[model samples]
Target: MTARWGNACDIVVFGGTGDLAMRKLLPALYYLHRDRHLHPQTRILALARARHEPEAYRRLVRRHVSQHVASADFSEDSWGSFSARLDYMPLDISQRLEFARLARHLGDSPGRVRVFYLATLPDLFAPTALHLHGAGLVDDQARIVLEKPLGESLATARRVNDQIGSVFDESRVFRIDHFLGKEAVQNLLALRFGNALFEPLWRNGHIDHVQISVLETVGVENRGAYYDQAGAMRDMVQNHLLQLLCLVAMEAPVHFEPEAVRNEKLKILEALRPITGMDVQDQTVRGQYSRGRRAGETLPAYYFEKSVDHDSNTETYVALRAEIDNWRWAGVPFYLRTGKSLAQRKSEIVIQFKSVPHRLFPGTTPEGNRLVIRLQPDESISLSLMAKSPGRGMALQEVELDLHFDEAFKRRRWDAYERLLLDVIEGDATLFMRRDEIEAAWRWVDPIIGGWQEVYRSPKRYAAGSWGPEAADSLLERAGHAWFDERGD
Candidate 1:
């Protein structure tokens, strides 16, 4: 498939030498170039303090990008063209004097889209924007892309937003949550709003409950310090899981424009019933992983990870029941759980429908219809329905109607970063979060964090290879529903 190219733009990556840039950003750009999604004139400027000539930087990037990008996608011919668009500049983002060098490198190109991708820490976000604006780099056509863990808490998030908002318009700021860039996630929006088959039956009356889980097989690894500080709630739930929940529970936007979609999402975030104080104990579970074997390999516990505190109380896993108090989803509970070092690495959304009011077949048992959307490892959508057994009278069995992206489409699937990068260049914010949306999400998540700090001083311990704490299973069991992992996908 020929990938579509957006407007010619200069993509400036702040932390160009960082893990995210080398592993995701550069590789995504390479695919965009290979697939013809990037204009020939588009430039990718690496802005970091690491001093390197253009040739040396390209060589470094080539090694990392080659290692990370799929073997089939990496080609000498494509690399030649992609490498030509690469440039580098060494500077301290904190130093206002370094801004002039960046501006000079960008040149005085008119009407070209400029995307400042802040892949650096949250602290640098505002300063970078300020520096850009001070150096006359900010323009109407300029857009900024921010990464996750926007802030440590609600107050800090607000401050960050205020600082960034001062320099760039909200429309031009793309607060990216890569989960929204996943193929299954986009397909989910299409499944809910594009199709008439599920829309009417998507509410409380027909759907029993919703489960959104993002489980990781790997522990903190190199992110021990950051993970300890942020934990699962701030790192995963505040952005990824909550964004998925909003997409699942939100009302159909009048149109699929950026604001049209975000407006409805904002409504869902606002409608989220607060899980605070006593509610936190009853509705939420936080777990820290202990030493255990995964896939025949023994792994250290969260506390023992490099740079992590020996007695860290930080949660490696979190499970919470979120309710949206709105007409579309009044009684329905949205079960959200995300963790590291789990049974497997998978992200999926399960919509289990309510069972039939009365079973007509006496000799057979009917299972409720379920729509399972898997987001990682393998991207596919499967709907489980009860059907009559092939050769038996009155016998029913569950059958799945599945759509696997790789098998169904016979083309290379675009990574989340590739799609998001293209969207930023195209000036599309539909897949990105707005400032109000961020504030609202923090508003909903703040109290939960506070509740954990005040009441639950330490997280429950679970084995590294396990699903999560037993409390998480009991969380679902109390309501007569088990996690999809526990129930068998």
Candidate 2:
């Protein structure tokens, strides 16, 4: 399946019949095909447990592809050419013999890259990797992609890693944290390192506080089976939020390579002050969303989902006051929260600067600038600064120096999937999480989760459309701060 498309070969997508494939993967591949990004003979072989011929898979894909792809220039000729590269193989991880067909289909294409994408559940990752090795699909240059919710805890994550490590070297594994592929997230690094102005103010003395939030307006759609076992802490904050913390808090590395950048991120993770013992209650807020409105529609609570336990202690919303115990960010507090069924969907980092030393006029407004890096709903950066209200009097107010993606960049913005997929093809691991980085994140995050089980009897309940539990606001209220909104940016 390897193609002459500039040295890359077939992208062997496992769980190709899953949600991610139907919505994001195939559509992206279609666009890549339409734009001539793929090589002349490049192929995309989809593997799944369903019994289907290549033609049947093509039909199934055609229906979804037509729906997800917009009206533009997908001609019959283009689809025919793209469909010619479409292939499928039925697979069940538990059955060893089933993988033999997969292996035979992938015949020896020396130097042809084989990209294995694991979109299935975590439990299936190890078995699939071993089966790949057993089927002789593991090569020195082959690549394997691992999706997140890495594991329930550090121990389980390590166990999964050990299982996968047995078959493939660390270099061959690509751990995707789609957040990193976000344009603004990547741009944050560029802003900090590329600009001479920001780095000087990036330290403790000049900065007052940092806030990171990744909220969702939608409820757990059809993931109740998985959501019940893992709450907001493990499902989102542990991997995604912690990684964002690393990116924002990590010291700049000399080089931007995978290991170099991750090394600095690991240091920031290691420098994270542990939140175990008694202080857990003071520093963290955990809650579950009850029924409420979202995106102009009513939504149910976490327990309302089918198959969810009535007495579940799993949290749907979480807010924490984390501190990095390093010279660069000694006293600055990094507040992070993520939840489902909230007021609005927003993923942003707000840097609230310290107030000016002295104020000359009694009635004059005080000045404080905040740098907001937003990820979703929109991808942009805005610096909130003080401006004089237009009048005869010297009244002060806030104005923004904004870099909205639409106004700033005219090119078609790439989705997180596209950037991450390209990174996989080009072997760029800067945006991908590495072994130690994942382990370290879990190491720091596991204790916070474990602490709640021992101390907090139950998760505080917030309305589905509410902005998490009332307790979440208290985490910052005592520090004289509040969460950012669309207008606040």
Candidate 3:
């Protein structure tokens, strides 16, 4: 690993011995290597600050790969091939001179893709990029991949973007939101823009409201320290939740290309009416989770976690309503909610259409059309519409017209990492978040965060295993809307 192994390589993971490295990046690269999606001569070089030989590093990767890969896809050959492509480089990214080894290893590989994957902390990004630039490692053909919680606020986020932009061109920088790579998420673009059936009706005139909920089954767990610093706003709402909203509210792209799709998303981001001052409490709710049962096992409160602050007011849950002031969605509301504990893990978009002008079946029961798209654990799309109740009378009943991606596709689809890794290798920034998109999200979100600080001064408390605080439910209930639970659970 110390000496140059080969010429061509697609990805170079910097924090290769870290959690994201073993848990996601390495295993993902294995799948690409197996499928021959990666170039034959391509290499996977792992760079970490620790001094570890090739075999030790391979053992580190193999241990994680073995645990993460599905049992069905597990194979000795897969491990052998993937491990063969591994190389290790030990250097402190913070040291400008230390990147010389990386530069030497990457010398004139010509036309081959080179991605500097930053699995490290946000503070290290600028220094790493500067060091890479200093070593002449960043060239026209090279790209850098950045992971999230870009910054705590819009100002900090802008600073990061500015610092990176100083060294690398906009095109060479790839900021990722993994949710964008999820099959169902990308399928959402196709489900709407690619289909004529849905595009015409994708507006305030036809659709009523949209619910984007990201729920987790577990609490902060090992992430307590990081969660306290980030909270739900920075951790999930700023990136994951906003990305989902963009996909839902964006106008139809002219073509499905990067610019076209991103242009539409940018419009949605720009059109987001700010939530601040008087609107903060009316439109948003922040809460912290207390001790409660996770899965029949009792869990500690956030304060009890190893590195957490006992008196922290950081929210474990955040729910808010946003609107695009543009004509297409002028009055339609988009509700965004995310929280840990008290929810079976679920991420879905519930499109609840307006009730009919009049209830023709007044004395009986009546309902409007609705559609639900579930992304995690399973991928499915179902349209809720009224249908006959099977007796002789026209007793109306709501039935779902369903299409489950799993049940129908019948293929053991690759995980999000697999697809994203392929995209990185193939030089497709289609699903990656662009700079404007990142800043735009922070711009819309920063105000609500500030308003929360100025107003409530602290988050409402809700027990673990419960659906957030009463304020959360009231946020929607006042608008005559309710949250949707996991389908059929």
TM-score list, all predictions? 0.97, 0.95, 0.95
Clashing pairs in 3: none
For residues 363-453, write the lDDT of model 3, one tens digit per residue: 5546668988889878888999888788676778889999988788987777888888677666678888888998898999888888988
Error of 1 at 466 (Å): 1.2
The order by descending lDDT is 1, 2, 3
- Candidate that scores best on lDDT: 1
Question: What lDDT tens digits, residue by residue, belong to model 2 across residues 277-331?
Answer: 8788999999988878755788887888877888788888889999999899999
Q: In candidate 1, which residue pairs clash? A: none
Report the C-alpha displacement of residue 326, candidate 2, in angstroms.
0.4
**Candidate 1 residue 284 C-alpha distance from true site, Å:** 0.2
For each candidate, the alpha-carbon lDDT, in order, equals 0.92, 0.86, 0.84
Query: How many angstroms is residue 378 displaced in model 3 relative to the true structure, after the best TM-score fit?
Result: 1.2
Which portions of model 2 show Cα errors greater than 4 Å?
1-5, 73-75, 294-296, 362-365, 486-489
Which numbered prediction scores highest in TM-score against the true structure? 1
